[model samples]
Target: MQNLPTSWSTPVGALTATGIGGVAMAVAALAVTADPAGRFLIGLAALGLLVVTALGLRQRPRLAIRDGNRGIVLQRLGGRLDVDRTELRRVRIVRYPRLGRRVPMLEIDVRPPGADDDRLLVFGRWDLGTDPTNVFDALNARGLVPPDPHRTPDR
Candidate 1:
């Protein structure tokens, strides 16, 4: 399967900030006090922050979705979330209520073999290298996305 291009600004920025903040806090703790217990607690907190930030950076949200041979992969910062083809149920474009207006977003609803409820994966336009419409069209062409019964013909 061909890999889709992706964008990674928002998540990268977040990761960068978290990493810098974590390190700064750790350094500040060392400089602030010489007491063992206080320094220990601060060190622990800083370590926790750094660890969480590192993990998040590895799987940051700004991603790309690529069609795999047997499933679709949500390509993240340094990892990929692979959803089996069988798990995928529907793909549609929806409007999100943001900043008092509706913004277009792609929503993929999936239900794994034994799951009771659907899991939703949402992606913004920036996530895809191209337009969401183009991605949708390509997926639809490959029979990955079923037509929306409620959608009007003009749409």
Candidate 2:
């Protein structure tokens, strides 16, 4: 098997390029379009794209598994969340239908040392720029998360 990366992150270059394209499209639509309704719809779409790009940029390096299997790091808008190996309670991949296709997500349950409650962190394909199943396999290969007996091997 091929070696897996220790970290997974959104493609910043792609996000930046998308944001720039949205701006260009919005500007072009406003300049070239004579119909008010058409310009409005195009502008709205561009705005949505920009918003998505901004959110993606805010959470750079979405997930990272520390070297030597020590811990995992999650980057968020407010700050970073670090979960040590001991704190990781469970890790699994969930699949659900979205827009007529199945989407996979990685969910990690962690309990901070001395914390009374556990936290669930979920990462989607957009966040990881890859399939959650691949991340699950990588984590399993690293022994960070054990194999799930209940999970089918079809993936």
lDDT of 1 by residue, 123-142 (tens): 76545534566666666655
Our tally of clashes for model 1 stands at: 0
Residue 57 displacement in candidate 1 (angstroms) = 1.6
**What does candidate 2's lDDT look like per residue over 1-155, in tens digits?**
24787788788777988899889878977886678887888888889888889888887789988877888888888889887888887888888889998888898889998889889888988789888889988888877884556766664
Instruction: Return the TM-score for candidate 1, rounded to 2 decimals.
Output: 0.53
lDDT over C-alpha atoms for residue 66 of model 2: 80
- Backbone clash numbers for all candidates listed: 0, 0
**Cα lDDT listed for each candidate:** 0.66, 0.83
- Specify the poorest-scoring 10-residue window by lDDT in model 1: 1-10
- The predictions' CA RMSDs to the true structure, in order, are 5.8, 2.8
